[model samples]
Target: MSTLPTGYRTVVVPPERIEELRTVDQLAFAVAPDPEADQLLPFPVPHDRLMAVESPDGTYAAVHGSYDLVMPVPGGQVACAGLTWVGVRPDERRRGLLRAMITTHLERSLERGEPVSALFAAEAPIYGRFGYGSAADQVRLTVPRGAALRPVAGSERLTVRLERVDPGRHAELVEDLYVRAGAGRPGWVPRATPALRAYTVGDPPGRRAGCEPLLLATVLDGQDVRGVALFARKASWGEDGADAVVKVREASALDPASTHRLWSFLLDLDLTTTVETPPLAVDDPLLHLLVDPRPTRRRLTDNLWVRLLDVPTALAARRYAGPADVVLEVTDVLLPANAGRWRLVVDADGAADLSRTDVDADVALDVRELGALYLGGRSAAAMGSAGLARGDRAALDRLTTAFASSLAPVCPFMF
Candidate 1:
């Protein structure tokens, strides 16, 4: 690990200190322990990967952990160390404790053969300096009830069923449908752990936020389940009329018809004047299905931040759009080994071959920008225009075309 501040030290958290870990997080996030939630949802972060910073007196000052995740990329997936549950005591603010923990996190992740690290940043600006770039964006939309959709063939053949969500009975179905829905899309990671699966459908009464118990609606074709939506409605009576809002926790469908059928039910639910959607990819099928999208209130934000710990492995893990041979000069502040020039050679099959080279660079950018482009969601030309990357027009165009994805990258569920 890199040198830490004076009087501060880092250590791997032991199983015995699980309560201490939770304590630090509770204080850091200002959340009180909910017994009902604890009973329904499992804490999934592995104890072995947990790390903590301690004061000279042996008190825990900060803590963090990583989840062993397989992140989907264009045409494939890669081993990703998902940095999560990061927290620091209020008194420990601005002491470089977080930075030291992140340094250790990267080093240990690389040692474990994870080429990339990804996270849902609690605060947007805290990660850019650490070489984590905003790699993908997600948008949420609020649509009025009865919004019309362009018809998709076979949508009328599908049927709908609504029932209360039961984690034990429906977790596997939700997981299966989710995987099928996100096939071939970059950054569409699945919940691999059983705890995460349970957490996905967990709905403790105390956590409802005044809404009714969670409900699950499925689109079916005879015996087969094609799509599912988890949602709830909070009733409200306004001067105008009943202004109930349907808030969707998540919605996934396997086919175009299923997508159309699923939303048709969601948008026309009785008593709901507005339907709030979960964060969706820019190219989500629902967007294309909407007859008119301009009227919806759309809010966009960064969804995922990626750090390329092993640049070559990370780059090679995903398929490119078109074949290209270009050299890149990559600058990585934390990992000097990733610094310097490299050549990326691609073939007609979209496969990549990367290696260190002394050849003059065709493009120059930091590892952060490379991470942003890793999943094929970001464009090299945009980075160049933003001054985050430097290169000639030809090289920028080539890189952009090589890395372009037919579908937008999105993480449907946050870690």
Candidate 2:
């Protein structure tokens, strides 16, 4: 456990003190409040999860919150604490306030039966020391308008409808399509609460950075909506001609044809010279359908950082890709309970049994590497090669195969 600074204490922020909490966040992040945005998109952090570090004089020195998230893993989902809204007052830096809050987060999450925690790191370097691992990578693409996609079987039959987004009418539909599109993919966390759902569709004028109001485009097959894209266009004029840029906030499809059709419409919008996408799964259908990807300006960024608070429970929650029988010596600094050797046995169906054992270890790794491999997106062999994991060569190869994911893990949106 991390020790708090002298004369500092932790406390749960009360509902009446939300403004005070917001003030701390605003000061920490250096952002001015937009009352219109807050009124349109309610804050998603639950009061029960809002915690702060109070200085000796009772002023908030730092704040953090977590979401009761059900995160998808290989072949299943597990209870997860989605860590978010972490901020420390500028004057409180290097005082161990962040470390103290993390200790509290892990303990409270485990008490709530969550064995795993995930976050979108504001800075990539901040969380690894706390046992969080970068488990997934997301891609953003900037494709020139009129770029062609390889044809899909039924793409021509799908019809497209584009209109201004009406959150009141489209929020539920967008959320439903999001759930279906991300089915069977690891780390796909749905908007489980009304506040989160509202946040997804909310487009207050203050939030638009000189772009048009949000737009909704749906790919339909008869009466069935097979795909949807939420986007906005920022108009521009150049010496040659119109150079508007279409920025897609979210895009998902139920089928290959829908995927092809959705991007086709998005990439060929009139008056738009470029179309940019939000972060997408590494194996997203759009990538496979693009005729040539070399020209698309791609940016790959770390998506989800994962921490296994209860190693045994977290390991058992996800299925393996293949049968495996091996002993692993895992080390965890923050959570000593997980630092030990364990035997993991997997059946043909990928179901795993994890228990403490006194057997000789076939592999040795830190809890961070284990968390990285938890979603099956990262390779054991790579970690072993980097010296982050130590294991027999054959064992490393086998572990890589068993832990590989058929679909690349992705968290479509930041928490």
Candidate 3:
């Protein structure tokens, strides 16, 4: 573990010190406090998982927290420490307080039997130095209102209803549809706790900047709910006419017809000129449903940054894609136990077994690259071509085939 500077120490943040922790993050992130929002939105992080660095004056200098999450992988799920709310006050910058806090977080997470850690990086470059790899990408689209969609078999029969979002009435419906929508996709993390669930549906007044109150759009077939979308419209007007924009917070659908029905309603809202989609997988169904996608504006961003704290356990947790017998020489600066040659053998059924090996490594790479490939979204051959991974050409091909996922990895919502 990295040592803290003299007279500085790591401490667990209790409920009473939650305000101090929030203050430190608000200062570091340069955001003003909104007490009204605080009352409406439940604090999502568990108090027991919050940690901070205390300076000599008995005040918090840096704060970080983790959520106990079950993250979906290629063929299964694993216990993941979703690292979040990390911040260090500007006055304490460059003092190694962040490093100390990270070490503490890693040790504590590992002790709790979590083999993986994932995060949505606020700043892209900072987490890479700490061994987190950019594992997935999400795209946001500004689709023109009234865009044409290719017809789905039953899309015409499904109906959409829009109403003010209610945690009491729509929380379970939203959560259930979200899980069903991303059934087989990697990195689809669900709201595992009540606090997280509440936060997802919470609509604090302070968060609405001139937009209408948050609304829920549900697609129904008879008595069954097939899809749900959380969104709001910001009113606007120009010389030409009403130029309102529909901003969707999140959307999920169970089937192709539901997806088509849901998006059709969102894209044709009254008085809206365009509809902004939430973070979507690169290969989202809506993209395929569109008759012409060239007119849509898109913004791509890194989605999940993954770090493997225990190499063998993490590797064994997720199934491989194809048959393979390859040895990887992994290097991890933060977790010394993970640095060594490990053999991964996958059977025809995609089950993998990773064990220590004395054999020559077929591929040699740092832990970051391995974590990036862990979800089966990244290609080993591409990494090798970029000189980020080193191995024979054929070995890289086999590794790529073994780790490939049918669907691109994505976490639709920020943690």
Model 2 misses residue 300 by how many Å?
0.6
Q: Write down the lDDT that model 2 would get.
A: 0.93
Better of 1 and 3 by lDDT: 3
What lDDT does candidate 3 reach at residue 343?
95
What is candidate 2's CA lDDT for residue 232? 98
Report the CA-based lDDT of candidate 3 relative to the real structure: 0.93
lDDT of each: 0.92, 0.93, 0.93
Superposition error at 47 for model 1 (Å): 1.6
Model 3 segments beyond 4 Å from truth?
Answer: none
> What are the per-residue Cα lDDT tens digits for candidate 2 across 1-101?
88898899999999988888888889888999988887778889999999999999999999999999999999999999999989999998999999999
Off by over 4 Å in 1: none
Clash list (residue pairs), candidate 2: none
How many pairs of residues in model 3 come into backbone collision?
A: 0
13, model 1: CA deviation in Å? 2.3
Clash pairs (backbone) in predicted model 1: none
